[model samples]
Target: MAQTKQTRGACAFCGRQMTGNGMVKHLSACPKRKDTLGESNPKSGKEEKIYHLKIQDAWLNDFWLHLEIRSSATLKDLDSYLRSIWLECCGHLSQFSTKGHLGEEIAMDSEVSALFHPGLELTHIYDFGDSSETLIKVVGEREGTPLNEHPIYLMARNELPEVETCACGKPGAWLCMDCTESEDEVALLCEKHAKDEQHQDHNLMPIINSPRTGRCGYAGPADPPY
Candidate 1:
């Protein structure tokens, strides 16, 4: 597969930017994170078992996320979050399974604590027909006060992957579905070319930060949970 340019994203807590691998190490020892954990806010909830999860597009290494979720949260909660942030275009069926898409199906109501462990990995498949698969791994766990009222907290995520420009040597921000379907060549286009007389007849999809980009009605990600 073709590789995307190296990308960096900001830490939700301190706004410090780092590469994906670098963010993993940084999150574990970030001073701001430590400080947040140390704060004794009266509004904080009781201690709970929180699991650190690493979620990544199964095919694209460039699209990924690090999350801390309360073990009490159900698989449904995780699924809902995934939909809101990345996959919900049409209300398509989704499932969490053991091996891959054909693996043992896990119930949506199952709690995180019931299924997750230090090294457990699961596959989440959305839109069975034009599916987007994500690999979810239990990176680590800790007993601590819940970060907020939400069942999960976003720690970090990958910045958008960079794409090659159009034939005109300008940035490509649109994709021509006709070209993609034909598989003759990449359909990336700059705004100018997207509206050009020769290209305007083809169906166009905007470039977005998602593995689902140009696929089955996916427009883009919803506002992230920070």
Candidate 2:
């Protein structure tokens, strides 16, 4: 079977699909947010953004952390979730990569906080040195380091429901059943669909017209066991 081209395009920051770049751009330009650097805060303001993350650890085949969290959630919060899920074998903060990428070297203390600030939906993939099934690079640059200061570009921004109506935009009601091949190809989950409890990716069966089922899609021989 041949899967169609669902990846559409690539993201500037990472190599993933344009969706990743779009998602970041949306968070960066969210109108609901006042500058976080301001001394005062908007009491009723809320920055509503969502992101996707996959646990690429080789040994932990039982864990599937396909979750959506607010942009404000901290890495510490995720650490807590891991603790709850794997009380005995959870990879502690020290064991995990600070940059979220497979082998990105970074300081997990305060610098990562500066780079991966809140209100940004980031899709991070990790490898616990098990079998290395990961293909994406979830990298973050040092706060003042060259890698952090380098400029990355994107083709387009991801869509969000809370944003203002654009003259050239359409509803992001579509689903991206990405084939998950190159690090440049990313799986996109629509924020509106998830929040409304309307249509979900998990429920979206390949209707035979989906692009992910074509030759370029690479769905392999069996569907995921969920």
What lDDT tens digits, residue by residue, belong to model 2 across residues 1-226?
2122322233333334443334444434434322321322334234333333433223222222223333344555554443333221223223334324445543323223344433333322322332122222232211211111111212222222121111224332333444235434533334444344433335332212112222222222222111
Q: Please provide TM-scores, in order, for all candidate models, with all chains considered together.
A: 0.92, 0.27
lDDT scores in order: 0.84, 0.30
lDDT of each residue in 135-224, candidate 1, tens digit only: 998877888887888888899888778787888999889988887745336679999989989886888888777777877888876556
Error of 2 at 13 (Å): 30
| Candidate 1 deviant stretches above 4 angstroms | 40-44, 181-184
* Location of the lowest summed lDDT over 10 successive residues in candidate 1: 178-187
**Each candidate: how many clashes?**
0, 13
Candidate 2's clash total is 13
RMSD of each: 2.0, 14.9
